[model samples]
Target chain A: DAGVTQSPTHLIKTRGQHVTLRCSPISGHKSVSWYQQVLGQGPQFIFQYYEKEERGRGNFPDRFSARQFPNYSSELNVNALLLGDSALYLCASSLVSGDGYTFGSGTRLTVV
Target chain B: AQKVTQAQTEISVVEKEDVTLDCVYETRDTTYYLFWYKQPPSGELVFLIRRNSFDEQNEISGRYSWNFQKSTSSFNFTITASQVVDSAVYFCALSAPIYNQGGKLIFGQGTELSVKP
Candidate 1:
């Protein structure tokens, strides 16, 4: 089966701009999670949605938000982007809340 | 609060060498899961293994081995006969039970491995 897929493998935005990243979960998966990975650091959780409901949120700011669709696809939105927001945004899917997760290649976002 | 620590920032070894990456975690949850993920230059997290808090058994798969010791609150990964292909940033992560924290993973800073062929 195809793994989780993320859109716009790479993109650039300016400060104060908004960005949206998309993710399609694996077939039969109901949970989608978002993570931000800064250079040389491990990924940090942003949000998780299960069955189209918000399951959990991380330590990110209000500028970060996400949602899951009926088909289990997800979208992460960042508002008023800052240079510090530049990072690799990863999407992961799992069959259940805490099961093994498969991650996407991630969308590389660069903010100027 | 839960946290994972990988004290080794980077490691370099020649091919055929054996190297162990150490991971120490802190969590109050008696029931939790530990995981190992390898992030190659491709920048995708490749799952390696996941062990439960109740399972202390060591696991071996091909040239890779994982040692899970609950007594030390540690999970360490060893790559035997390392190769250039094994070079990557390896992460150790911890996750709470399903009902806790939405199963979000708590990851360590990661250890970058450089294998010289």
Candidate 2:
């Protein structure tokens, strides 16, 4: 079976610019969550969507937003990007609230 | 706010040696979930294990084992007979009760493991 998939494995953007990352969950999965991983750090949760609705959000600022489409694919949008926004963006999918999660390889974003 | 601490920033051990990664968590809520994930050089996050608050049983899976201690608020992972393939960054994470505010996950800084031949 296919695992979580993300698009544009690498990206580059400039300050004040906007970027959008994409993710497609594994087949039959209903929950999708986004995470940011800086160099030498663990992945930090950004947003989680379940059943096509927002279920959770992390400590990220309002400049970061995400939405899940009817097909269960997800997009994470960052506005006015800062150098600090450069990191690996990960997408994870799980079956339910307490089940194990499967993560995508992630999009490596570099904002100059 | 919930937080997880992994004091061991980096660890190195010869192949076949044993090593343990420590994780300490702080949360005011009584019910929570803990997890450990491994990220290999390929940058894919792999789920190692997950432990709920009520389950304190130590679990052993092949060469990987988890020691969950509620007293110290810690969930440590130990690898026996480590291999070069075991080199990766390990992350400890916490998830609040599903009904608490929102089911967000709080993560630790992570520990980088290097296994040598």
Candidate 3:
């Protein structure tokens, strides 16, 4: 079975622009979570959705938002992007909230 | 607040040598989970192992092994007879059920392991 998949593996955007990153969770997985990883740093949690409902959110600002569809696919939207927002956005899928997660290759967003 | 610490920023070892990566965590919750992930140059976080608070048993899978110690609050990973394939950035993470955070994972800074042939 295919693992979690992300689209637009790489992207470049200007500051103050908006961008959307997409993720398709593994088949039979119900939970999807988002994380942001800065260069030379580990990933930081962003948001998590289960059964199309927001279950958890990290310390990110209001500019960052995410939603999960009934099929368990997810999209992370970032508005008013700042140069600090440039990082690797990763998507992970899990069977349950506390279970092990399977991660995607991640979308690399570069804000210039 | 929960925190995971990976003191070693990077380590290098020759082929067939053994290497151990250290991880220390802090959490007030009595129940929680610990995890180890490997991010290769390709940039995908691969799940390696997960251990819970109740089980402290050391586990070994092929050439990989993990030591979870509650007394020291450490979960260390070791690679036996390491190979170039094992070179990657290894991360240690912790998760606990917080009021608004649910069980979101808090990751450490990660340890970059370089295996030389």
Predicted structure with the largest lDDT when compared to the true one: 1
lDDT of 1 at A23: 99
Strongest candidate by DockQ: 1
Which numbered prediction scores highest in TM-score against the true structure? 1
Off by over 4 Å in 2: none
Worst 10 residues of 2 chain A by lDDT: A93-102
Clash pairs of candidate 2? none
Off by over 4 Å in 1: none
Tens digits of per-residue lDDT, candidate 3, B39-116, equal 998899999998989999999999999999999999999999999999999999998774546578999999999999
Candidate lDDT scores, in order, read 0.95, 0.90, 0.94
Relative to the real complex, the DockQ score for model 2 comes to 0.65
- How would you order the candidates by lDDT, starting with the best? 1, 3, 2
What DockQ does each prediction reach against the true complex? 0.87, 0.65, 0.75
- Residue A100 shift from truth in candidate 2, angstroms: 2.6
Q: Report the C-alpha displacement of residue A82, candidate 3, in angstroms.
A: 0.6
DockQ-derived CAPRI band for the predicted complex in model 3: medium
Which candidate do you rate higher for TM-score, 1 or 2?
A: 1
Q: Can you write out model 1's per-residue Cα lDDT over A1-112, one digit (the tens) per residue? A: 7889999999999999999999999999999999999999999999989999998999999999999998899999999999999999999999989888999999999999
